[model samples]
Target: MLKRIGYTAGGFVLIGVLAVAILWGLSVGTVQFSLSQIFNIVMDQFSSPLAIDDPLNGPEQTIIWLLRMPRLLMAAIIGAGLAVSGVIMQAIVKNPLADPYILGISSGASLGATVAILFGIGVMFGENFVGIMAFIGAMAISFGVLFISNLGGRPNSVKLILGGLALSAVCSSFSSFVVYLADDKEGIQTITYWLMGSFAGAKWDMLPFIAVVVLVSIIFFWSQSRILNMMLLGDEVAITLGRDLHTYRQVYLIISSLIIGFVVYAAGMIGFVGLLIPHLVRMTIGTNHWTLIPFSALGGSIFLVIADGLCRCIIPHAELPIGILISLIGAPTFVYMLVRKNYGFGGE
Candidate 1:
């Protein structure tokens, strides 16, 4: 009972933190707003039709509602999706080092974005052409990895990882080739920034698709927690228990691909959240998927929200790319986890 209560309490705390982080994120950047002001602005949306037209500052309202809200929400959603993807990938391959991009999704997205940004392939999508191309790239590579891994025989964990790595190299080489051929210096600079990741392009129009993909994937994966736990026991053990994870693994890959592709479309390539959040949650809550999934989702959201907030304020007059900020913060934290032998990563 106490353990259950503790878990429940922890969940509430995380939700509270997420709420605060959202408001804090809104308060950052050049124009700042207090929590009360942010609250009033948000509440005004729910007010009666007779509500005054100018309840809050005009530019501030635009900044908070139109800009920061979507961006921060995207960060939270992507973070949650990536963390859950990491959890599933780690379980499927039985490898602690696995991450959401272990299947070459990131490379594919990068390649697609490179093509669109440099070659103008999907410029028809206007503002979202790069993101659309990235989604195409990610989905293609994910399915390609699965197909190649199964070509020799029944796909196994080893083949999947190897296939992903091989295709990732191919995609990276192609991206490099495209970049090398491009003579547009400013376009190259744009590609560099996009590769590092940013949420500056986030808008309400993109939220519906991204939210649906991430939320649906999260719900579906969380429902499969029992099987995921069994997967950690190895195929032999899982088979003994009458659960063949081979087919399920492929389905998961597709779902993860969808979630990851949407994230790439929205936020470029923010890393480490997926790789780091699951391990952190596992360290505190043990390996039970019931607890692991929800905690990891919330924790991932918090991590990204805080990271995004830092990116906005860390510089004097400019915002840092969120991907770079996460790398700067996550690398040291990851090293610390590696050095401290206490976490065990399920081996101990």
Candidate 2:
């Protein structure tokens, strides 16, 4: 117990240090704001409704609030949502490698967004309709994966994985066909960018819905830590322990699909944080989700905030696509982890 507590504390502190680094990066961006100015903007946000203020507090306030702040928030929320869904999907399927993006939810969502943009569908919901359709597409893929795997018998972890890969290929091909057919130069450009992902679209209107969904799911999953721990032990073992993980796994996949749907709608296809962060947390905190889930969620949020900050400041006038950044970093790290083989979040 003491060891678990210690690991959790260490993870939280490490993440806190990373958070400070992220804030420093934000204040040091191309549009520089002094640390004091950044502090003042944060204080002002709490003290008043409008950022409408004195001229001396001008560009600093704008830089801190208008640009960097929303991006940071989106990064954090998307990170938490991905990590949380990763935890749930891993528990549900009893696989160390399961991630929403890997399991085809993201591909399905990309297809939905492409359809919405090209065909002029879902217009009534205005700007948000694309996200809604993406959510629908994601859930459809999730069920498709589940049902297809269950065709012969109860889905083992291997079968679930196989199903996800096949469905993901189908979705990707369909999306590619749509892009090919459109032949609209701007539309193709938009689709290409969306596939790479960005938090540059962050806005105040977008915050509440995603935040609440992520937070509520985090709380819900935190309470199920024991069940998740059992899930990792495999199906027969879980059954012996008197839990029917079949229904439970389905429930978790559905909930994760909902979260992933919303996240994909908002953030596009930022990948690997889900796969990488949980394993990193598990390496430090062990497989116990009680500590692991919450810490992983916090760690993920911190990671993305820092990553998003890096994406913003790395160039003078342009932003790096976050999906590319995560893949670039995550792939090397994943290879290192696989080669090292000492950390052991169940990878063989």
Candidate 3:
């Protein structure tokens, strides 16, 4: 009872923090807006969705509604998706180091987006062609990993990881080769920026799709908490208990891949949230997926919102790639956690 009450209180606290961070995020960037002004604008917009003129200044409305809101929302959504993906992957592979990219999703998406940018494939999809191709590439590589891992024998955690790493290398090498052969300086720069990851491309049109995918995936995984618990118990133990985990693992992988595909398409390759957030939540709470999943989602959302805010204001008159900032912050924090023996990779 106490634990449940504590978790509920923590959830409320996180939601409050997320709200403040969203408002703070709106106030960040080149031109600053106050929280009260932002509040009024949001309330006014909600009250009158079709109003041509908002109470805030023209530029303020544009920055808050058109720019910062979508980006901040995307940061939260992407963070939650990646963190949930991390939790699922860790359970599927039964490995502490497993992350969203463990199945080569990011590399495949990068390859697809690169090809679309350089070769002009999938242009019929309109402005989102690159994202479309990225989604396709991510799914393709995910299935490829599954197939390759099963080639030798029954696919296990080690085999799956090896297969994914091998395919990731292949996709990366091909992507580099394409870039090298193209020799388009501008396109090369675009690819570099895309790989580094930014929420600058967030648009209102894309938000609905991203929101639906992430939210649905989170709910679905939460519903499967029992199976997830079983997965972490090892295949032999799971089978001894009259439950086969192989099929369920594959299904979970496909679902995770779909979540990651949309995220990569929406926000490029933001890293470490997947690698870091789940472990942080696991350290605080126990390994129960029911508790770990929701906390990780909320914690990850908060983490990314703050990260995006820092990225906007860290330098003078410029924004850094969110991916770079995450690495910069996450690497040191992860090291500290690694050195601290209190939380021994869910063994505590």
Candidate 4:
């Protein structure tokens, strides 16, 4: 009972931190707003309808509602999604080093985005053709990994990892080849920026779809915590208990792939959140998925919001790519975790 109460209290604390992060994120861009002003704008926007000439519909409202809100929300969603994906991927592979992109999704998405940006290959898909192609490529590579791993026999973690590495190499080579052959400096710069990841393009119109997909996936995984725990004990143990983990592994992979695909589509290639957030949460709370999943989600949301806010203000009149900042911070933190004698996967 004490442990459960502590978890609940920790959860509330995380939510509070997330709320403060969101408010700070909304306030700290090129045009700063006081917390009180931000509060009034949000309340006014929600509490009453806007008239064309209403003072509330002026620049502050535009900045708060039309610009910053969606971007922050996107950050939260992507953070939660990636963190949860990490937990799932680690469990699936029974490896502490596993990440959401372990299935070659990142390489495949980069290849697709490279092609779309450099050659206009998927212009027919609409204004967001690049994102569309990325999603398709990620899914394709996930399926390819599954197929390759299953080629000789029933797939195991070793087979899955090998297959993913092979396909990732292939996709990366193709992306590089295309970039080298194109010789388009502008397109090259665009591809580089996209790969670094940002939520600058987030719009309210896009939020509903992405939010629904990510939220539903997180909930679904939480519901399968028992199976995830079983996976950690290995397939032999699972079978001895009258459950075959083969199908569950495949389903979880597919679901994780979908989460990652949308994340890449919405925010390009933010890294480290998937690889770092789960480890942080696991260290703090232990690895019972029931608590780990929700804590990681909230922790991730808070981390990304603060990171994004820092990215916006770290440079004068310029915003940093979120992916670069995360990599910079996550790498050192991860290394420290590794060197610590007390740290162990799933709390040992």
Candidate 5:
């Protein structure tokens, strides 16, 4: 009971931190707003219909509700999705080093974005053709990985990892080839920036779809916590217990692929969150997926919200790309975790 209470307290603390981070994200940026002003603006949304048009702070309301809120929400959603996906990937492959992009999803998305941006492919899909094509590419590569892995025998962890790596290499080569052939300098710069990642394009219109997808995926994975735990014990143990885990692994991969695809479509290629956030949660809480999933979700949201806020104000009149900033932080933090003798990545 005491342990449960402790976990509950930790959860509340994480949620509190996430809430504060959201508020901070709203208040930062070029046109800053005081906390009180932010409060009034938020309250105005729930005020009487007559007062709706006349906000407490009109300009601030527009800035917060229209611009910052959507971006911050996207950050939170993407962060949660990536973190949960990481947990699932690690469990699926039973490898501590595995991440959401281990299946070449990133490479596929990059290739799709590269094609759409440079060659104008998928333009018929609409204004967001780049993201759409990227999603398609990600899904295609995920299926391709599965197909390759299933060749000649039932797919296993080793086969899956090898398949992913091979497809990743192939997709990367194709993306590079496209870049080499395309002479559009502006397009190349756009690809570079998109690959680096940013929430600058986040809007209210795109949030609903991405948020629903991510939320549903997280819930699904959390529901399968028991099976995920068994996966760590290997196929032999799982079979002895009458749980195959083969189908479960594939299903998890497909679901995680959806999460990654939409994430890439919405926010470009933000890395390190999927790789770092799960491990951080594991280090804090025990590796039980029941605890790990929710905690990792909250932790990821907090990290990205704070990161996005810093990105807005880290330099005057210029916003930093979120992916670059996260990599800068994640790389060093990960190294520290690696060197720590006590941190056995949940193996101990």
Candidate 6:
């Protein structure tokens, strides 16, 4: 028990260090900021400037405040959203190989974004339309998977995966079809970037909505961690405890889908945090979602912030897509965990 507390405390410190590192990453970019300038921006508010009209400003302030800060904040949200959702999904399915994206949420959201961008289906919503469509698309895929799997019988993980795969394939094919037919070069380019994933589109306006949704969902799931642990025990054992999980399972899926919808809208499907962070937490803390959920959320934010920072600094004048950077580092880390620990979602 004491050891568990140590791990939790250690986890918090680790998160802090990562947060600082990410801020440093935000500062040292194409237009670098000295520690003092960075400090000033952090301290300054609507009240007054950090210094008495410090001349050492302008583009640096604009770059830090307007560009990098929002991007990094979005990364934190996406990372935490994906990781927490991944933890929830893995728990629900009792599968070690589960991630929010693995169940086709990302693909579904992508398809929705593509349709809106290409056909302007939800353009009536104006600037917010694209995100609204993506949310609808995520819910669509989730329901499709649930409906298909339940038609035959209980949705064991196998049926769930297969259902997600079929729906994802259909969505991807349709998106491709639309792109193929569209003559607009600009539309095609928009789809391409949307597919790759980014925080470059991050705006203060959108971040608040995303933050509230993600934070609220995290709190909601954190309360259910005890039940989540039962999920890993499989349906048979769960029934023995007088709690059949079919209803709760669906509840988690829908809630996580909402979170994923927001993340996909904000970041365009930054992968790895969902897949990698939970695995790491499970490796360190075991399958207990009580600890896993919050820990994974913090870890995911740190991971993404650092990754985004790398994206900014890696190329002198340009940025790498956060999605690709996550894959580059996260995939190998996952492989190593799978090979070494061979942990089986705490089931085996």
Residue pairs with clashing backbones, model 2: none
- lDDT string for model 4 (213-271, tens) is 99999999999999998888999999999999999999999999999999999999988
Residue by residue across 1-348, what tens digits does model 3's lDDT show?
Answer: 998999999999999999999989999888888889999888876886633344544776777887899999999999899999999999988888889998788899999999999999999999989889999999999999999988978888888898999999999999999998998899989888988889999988789988998999999999999989988889999999999888888899999999999998898888889989999888788899998999999989999999999899989799999989999988898788778777445755
Candidate 5 regions exceeding 4 Å error are 48-57, 342-344
Kindly list the per-residue Cα lDDT of model 2 for residues 106-157, writing each as its tens digit: 8889888899888867878778787777888898999998898789988767
lDDT values for all models: 0.87, 0.81, 0.89, 0.92, 0.91, 0.82
Per-candidate TM-scores read 0.95, 0.92, 0.96, 0.97, 0.96, 0.92
Backbone steric clashes in candidate 3, count: 0
Best by TM-score: 4
In terms of lDDT, which candidate is strongest?
4
lDDT of 6 by residue, 1-348 (tens): 998789768887977877797678767767888888877776663346433245655776667776788788888888889999999888877787788977788778988988899889998878868877888899899988889889877777677788888898988898888888877799889877777788888877778988999999999999998889888788899899998888888888989998998887777767777878888887777777878888898889888888878888899999888778888997888787777746667524
Error of 2 at 53 (Å): 12
Cα lDDT tens digits for candidate 1, 1-348: 999999999999999999988878989886778988888877865573222244654766677777898889988988899999999888877888889999899999999999999899998888789989999999999999999988978887888999999999999999999988998899899999998898888887788888888888888888999998898888889889998888998998899889889889888998998888999899888898888998999999988988888888889789999989889888998888788767445536
- What lDDT is reached at residue 62 by model 6? 66
Clashes of each: 0, 0, 0, 0, 0, 0
For candidate 2, the 10 contiguous residues with the lowest summed lDDT are 49-58
Model 2 TM-score (2 dp): 0.92
TM-score of 4: 0.97
Instruction: Give residue 124's lDDT in candidate 6 (0 to 100).
Output: 87
When sorted by lDDT, best at the front, the candidate numbers are 4, 5, 3, 1, 6, 2
TM-score of 3: 0.96
lDDT of 1: 0.87
Question: Candidate 4 or 5, higher lDDT?
Answer: 4
Model 5, span 290-322: residue lDDT tens: 899999999889999999999999999899999
The ten-residue window of minimal lDDT in model 3 covers 48-57
Q: Residue 303's C-alpha lDDT in candidate 1?
A: 89
Model 1: colliding residue pairs: none
